[model samples]
Target: MWQIFSRFLALGLISFGGPAAHIGYFRKAFVDDLQWLDSKQYASFVALSQFMPGPGSSQVGFAIGYHKGGVLGGLAAFLGFTLPSFLLLFLFAVTSAQWLEISAVQGIIHGLKLLAVVVVADATLSMFTQFCQRKTAKMLMATTAVAIILMPSMLMQIAVLVMAAIIGGILLTRGENITPENPPITLNYSWLALFILCLASSLYFIGQDDTIGQIFAQFFQVGSLVFGGGHVVLPLLEASVGDYITPDRFLTGYALAQAIPGPMFTLATFLGADLWLESPILGAIVATIAIFLPGFLLMLVGLKSWHTISQRPHIAGVLAGVNAAVVGLLFAALYQPVFTSAVIMPLDMALVIIGFSLLKVFKPGIVWLVMGFAATGALLTLI
Candidate 1:
């Protein structure tokens, strides 16, 4: 359990490229390296996490923990996987003003937006290969992509996901048997009680005027309420910080978050720093905790009943639909944040094409691509 926790903690600190990249990291570390679970089991866990609310990576971590040490193990896994980014973000939040204002930082941020395009594209393709095997799933993917391109709204995307689940549940219910391959596992209620106690303590601390309290509350709320994964948190976070921070600064931190190699929620660090300019450290801590709270809570709730839930025929169909919808959401994000912000000139367009091609054709390591792009962007900025 300690070993698993340590591994996830290290990955959490360094794993970047959003949820998709995080998934890759989890697969490499836990699936390929550890041989902890088979490919099918890993895929099933991925599917289950996507179907449930909160960050997909966090849930994956929770699943790993559960596999290792039961419910307590799950909590340790969640903490290990999430703490690094949270700490880094908290640090960044404390020093945001100076860190964000650097010209080199601006250039790198611009480059990172382009990287997002490649990451999202690669993720979409990978998911398609893994999940979009059936005709119904293919149709759903195509239809959702079109809807997102034609009418772009987060709400609409969510509605489509819900509708797809309903349709899929109706259609895919025939001749389906729901059974768990693995025997049902027992949960430690004492661990659950401890989790509740921590949550209560977190809530109480949130009301205090100290920097720690403010951050605790804010991040806890973000983590608890956010339903979808990292991408879905954007609008909610945008709303949360809008009253407190400026658009330009927010965009800057957002761009930096893209450039970094970890969870997107690390943007909380940037936001936290911006919010408490005089105390950037406090900001980073707040941001880190706020973004992760939801994933932790959801994982606990989901793990408690994952065996029963996984065995439902309708649940599989709904997950299939949700995965398709996730692809659509990624497509929309590519257009809005990646294309709209970064792909302006012909040179930028060329880079995007090349980046997409590199990902699709060579299937290069994401970390390498990000580094290569960051270097190329730096050179371009100088030129």
Candidate 2:
């Protein structure tokens, strides 16, 4: 437990670049350094995380913790891995926006965005290689990407994923579908009930205006409904919460989240604190907790039966299709706000290319990349 705490805490502080990069960080830490889990086990955890509807990388981390020390270990891992982002978001919430105006801070954010491009590009390639080995799968990946780009929205994302699943079921069921080993076979009725209750309660309470209840309900709904990656939640949250928080602050939080480690879902912490300035800490805690609770609940409930479900050929095909759609989702996100928003200049694109080369060839850990890029950006801004 202590080892998990220390290692994940380290990850939380320096693991920027969002879910994809965070997964790479986790693989390096757990699979390579600690040897806590083998590659296959970690891959299985990632597969389950991606298949579920929660925060992608965070769920993977939670599953790893659950495997390590049962529920308590899972909690420890969540707290440890998430603590840094919690602190950073809380600070961003309380601090003046002028702080972001500082040259160094802007530099840090610029560098981080460049880092995000590299990390996400790597993840897209890696997932394609692993999941889209077949020609049909590859074609589906391209088709999904084109569809999302042509008609991008929250509804479109969900629709594309569903269509991808149907296509997967129809097209991918030809081969043997072996169940992944070490399946979580136990069912907790109370857990599922609680998940349903929380979801229902949040929906029930979404209409309360100018109240914490409304905030909680909105964030909770975003958590419950958004699929694929953390970035996918942007449009949903933007549509739902835009009425309360100004677009600038919201975009700022989003960009800042890209720079920080841990789950991008922690953007809830900043939003909560900013919205309820009278009691910022309470706001931060409630908002953060509300947004993530649904995912954790669903994961805890679903992990118990996912592998058994995966054993069916049709279901496996669906998962395969869903996986392809996920890559498409990430690919679409990388283009819209991520690439479009960040890489505005040739220098920015050049920085990203250099970062990618470093990542592929030198293979430095994320901490160094964050620092090096931050410094480079800061120096350039000063110059």
- Residues 1-383 of candidate 2 have per-residue lDDT tens digits of 88777778988887766688889999998899888889988887787777777788888888888888888888788889899999988987788566888888887777766776777677677777888888778888888788877887557766877888999999988676475364556766777898888888887788777788877887887787666657766656765677788765676677667666789888889888987878999889888888777777777876767767657778778878887877777677678656776787899999999998998899887667767777887887887
Quote model 1's TM-score: 0.76
Off by over 4 Å in 1: 1-4, 13-44, 70-72, 99-102, 128-158, 172-175, 178-248, 276-283
Candidates in order, TM-scores: namely 0.76, 0.82
TM-score of 2: 0.82
Looking at model 1, report the run of 10 residues with the lowest lDDT sum: 219-228
lDDT of each: 0.68, 0.78
- Residue by residue across 1-383, what tens digits does model 1's lDDT show? 78878988789767866787788889998899989888877886776677666677777877877877887888788778767766665555555557656766666766777776666566667777766777777777778767866876545655677777776676645455767364565564654575567567667876565466666666666565444476655544654555577655565566666665666766777777776666777666666666666566555665656657767777777777666656655566556544676777898788888988987788777678768887887777677
